[model samples]
Target: MTQSTTRTSSVPPLPPPKERRRLREAKAMTEKQVAEALGVTQTTVRSWETGRTSPQGRRREAYARLLETYAAELDEKKHAKRKRRSKNPENAATARPAPETEAASTAAPTPSRKKPLNRRPVRTVQADSRSRQNAQRRKEKAAALAGAAAAEAAKLTPAQAFDELYAYASPALVRQTYLLTGRRTLAQESVERAFHLAWHRWPEVAVDRDPAGWVRGAAYDYATSPWHRFRRAHRHPDPPNGERAGRALRKALLDLPPVYRRTLLLYDGLGLDLPETAAETEATTPAAANRLLHAREAVAERLPDLSDAHVLHERLRELTETVSAPAVASAPAVRVSSERRAKFWTRAAIAVTVLIIGATAFTVVTAPRQYEPTPAPGQRVGGVPAPMGPQKLSRQDLKLRAKLRDVPMNGPERLVPRIP
Candidate 1:
């Protein structure tokens, strides 16, 4: 009898815990199933997958082999599914209709209708060119019209521009100020003052992207300014049915930070959108949105019953509208006399002319002075001759120089006292 030798093969290394978990997922095996297949606790499989602990010895080898077998099975199933799908692609694309009964089939078959063709009319080259030229002419005409309109607008005086803007913006600004200040008189005053400033600086204000926003900001500042603190002592009459909610809303709004209060008023009180509110508040859109959110939260906390934004906005509108805004006149009142205006212009011209003269004088006085260039070596400068070389001194001159060296340089020269 001859003895046969048995050769053992080495097991491959196991992948990392994450890779093991991914492989298990690929195989569609849950942790419990994988644990049961390897004859281990589900917790142990979880620990292995989570990298807290791992399988060892025979368990590790078994797990790896099980995962390999499952992966191969999954691949085989996928390949079979693909092959089946390819074999009957139409069946895969759409569900097959149930087989018709013999009686139904014996009935008349429905006629099939063909889909209509979508054919675009072809254009000739000449027609295409003509159409292109017509479109170009229309575009040029539109551009010219736009330019002419802009030129006409530019020709309007600053006062005219202010009149146009003020007519539409004054009422809204007055209402917004009323919401901010909670005083009808102060609100009216604030709107008037802001518009007055805008009127005075119409040349500058009209060029701004949002002149209405500028006026709104100015009015808000005026309404909240400390100079108008005297108005707080005076009580204003509230409209009918607005006493309680108006007081509560005013107290809540006043308690908020200025930015938050302004944001809330612009967004909810005035029905301005977020971007428009941001422009009015001199803040970025996101920052304005955040301020509005914070304001709403704060107000909601104060008045729990009125937590909804729409409800709060409606309530605020009612409160603001209760106090009627001052009527906007067709034309702004001219407060300054014609003589005062003339005097103001005259003074401004004098100041400007004085500044120009002063600047000219300063330029002349501080400017570099012109002078003749220094003469070259061996040439005469002014009336003095330029020294050509070192000069030989006489005995008297040398004695004079030695005497000068012994004299004090800074103060008066004194003769040295000789020793007796």
Candidate 2:
């Protein structure tokens, strides 16, 4: 059917949320069953029931019709139940009081008024009620404050949020990155580049639930990016300090797989929850936990003294602190650099686009407009050559020809110019 016809098709009205659920339940149907019958997901059926979204187009019509059928079935079932009850005299009799009993109950004498039951003192009751109300008010106030804070956070502009995140996260990330890659320069460069990227993608970072984590992931990825192997500065790792424990721990970390190392850092070093670590490292929770376990075991074997997570965290912190780097790049510097980089890329893209357009236009201009059939490889004779006209015979040539014709009776010998 055409869109207009589909739009105008009368999809039957559906009951409200409660009624919808009641109808389904009365029909002894589950959301899954209904979803299967309608060729939709259980979540879709749930959304329809909860009024989050309504099915549209053919699905809507189908669902509405299905509900109607379910309602009809329920009605039939109810009618059957009513008929059965009516046919069962015992049940019907128990369903309503006899007319005589009802009259007798009404005619029965009223009992004497009893003393007022012991009641809670008004003061105590009022105090308890007041206390409960006060408690509720306090809870509501706390909730409101939390909501207000969240709203305030939400109100921040993308740049403001990004700047805030950068200011808070960049320095620590720089240090953490140093721990990840043993190079201070790479750490600074990676952190700055990561921030530049975050600034460039501020809109996404700002809306992200974990902006810090987002930035951290980027920094980690850049710090450990495989292509860095080709860079002269990254060809060899920075030498570890005199501390044997720190050296061994760094060695152990380097020995671990990239994913496992990242997981360990996120879980043990940064003290993130297993799930959060898994999310950041892009691994399953169990995998992350397993990585953390194996990493810890490896590190413990390498540096038994620093086996405890707390001690390991402290040692990592100490190791990062051991490397003294200059002050970090400011958020504004990163933001400015990001803007400059983006501007450069944008101009480059425009230039490339313009070049393409120019090339296309030139091609269009230079292109042959109309189809011209290619001539054959051989040139056409300019004019049909005058069919070999007989040249006026020279006197000698004419005499030779007449003599040959007169001697024609000599057979082949005549053509060979033999004397008669």
Candidate 3:
């Protein structure tokens, strides 16, 4: 179906200003009274009531207040009508009606007279009503309490569940991956793949006393995997040789052996103490972990700008400290593409046109010299063999030869024709 450009008016378009005035008048309030309540001039109120203009912003607030007062007055009028019908003027004027008159009023009780007897039933009714209300209140309270308990149960602490583990493990993970593959891409990929594996089994994994251990194991396997290891070897074919801190550090980190690099990162980069590193790495003690760290330090000595162990440590510290937490990954949403595909095709056509125009401009700016075919050697004006190639020369070549009839050649075959 085609969409509408112009909006359709509703069946009763809108009430006219005259009709609104009638409605206001029916409520027994003058425009002046409403204007006084709204803090507006009587003329403004008259304009709105007559639909000459509509109230807006704070004026609407005043209009709404006036309407509410009108409604209350109508309710009062209704109550007064009902009271007049229910009460006899004589009974209304007296403090208490005589017993006979009261009985006479009730013989065929009208709605007004019936209200007393109906009201007399309220004592028992009030007790029942209060009991029902109290029961409802208790039920609501119980439900709210249960809801609170359920909410508390569902809450999981990310700081405890992931942050602690991340802080404890990230450095080691980064370092180990870097060392094994000797490439930044491999190390990063391995770490991500390892976490992906852990996330897949979070329920069972979280219950384990040593979740980080599970993650490290997963990471180690990923780094050592045949496919991953191959990729790591070729990850950074051209490591930049520069003084930029991040680039140098990236290059250095990518050059480590898997084990020592992992150990160093876990121990230093991630701020994991030796014991934690040992647990994650499945090493026996802090001494073994320290030995691996020393090995990494020794390797750092060989790199050009990384002269001192302290320098490498400081660089690593700075990089690691400045690192922001990794963002949470989300499942890709399923997309509906018909509309998007149309938009894409439209944009692509426009882009192609722009590109073609730009290419035309570029060609004109860097136009190559026009090729003029050389006249065939010793060939005459009208019958000369084309000098250039297998293809026949253009008429311009003939013109040049005719214009330069006095030109000389060293030999018939001396000037080898140029090959484009």
Local accuracy of candidate 1 as per-residue lDDT tens digits, 143-251? 9997997798799886677777877788877877766766677777778777776776666566554678777777887887766655545344334334554777888
Worst 10 residues of 1 by lDDT: 112-121
In model 2, the runs with Cα more than 4 Å from the true position are 1-139, 147-162, 241-245, 307-314, 317-326, 371-420
Model 1 clashing residue pairs (backbone): none
Arrange candidates by lDDT, descending. Answer: 2, 1, 3
Q: What total of clashing residue pairs does each candidate reach?
A: 0, 0, 13
lDDT of each: 0.70, 0.75, 0.58
Model 2, 76-128: lDDT tens digits are 98889965653454433434447885566568833311223333335555766
**Candidate 1 Cα misplacement greater than 4 A, ranges:** 1-157, 230-245, 318-322, 326-330, 334-420
Could you estimate the TM-score for every candidate? 0.43, 0.55, 0.33
- Predicted model with the maximum TM-score: 2
- Score candidate 3 by lDDT: 0.58
Model 3, runs deviating above 4 Å = 1-153, 156-188, 209-213, 224-227, 231-243, 303-312, 321-420
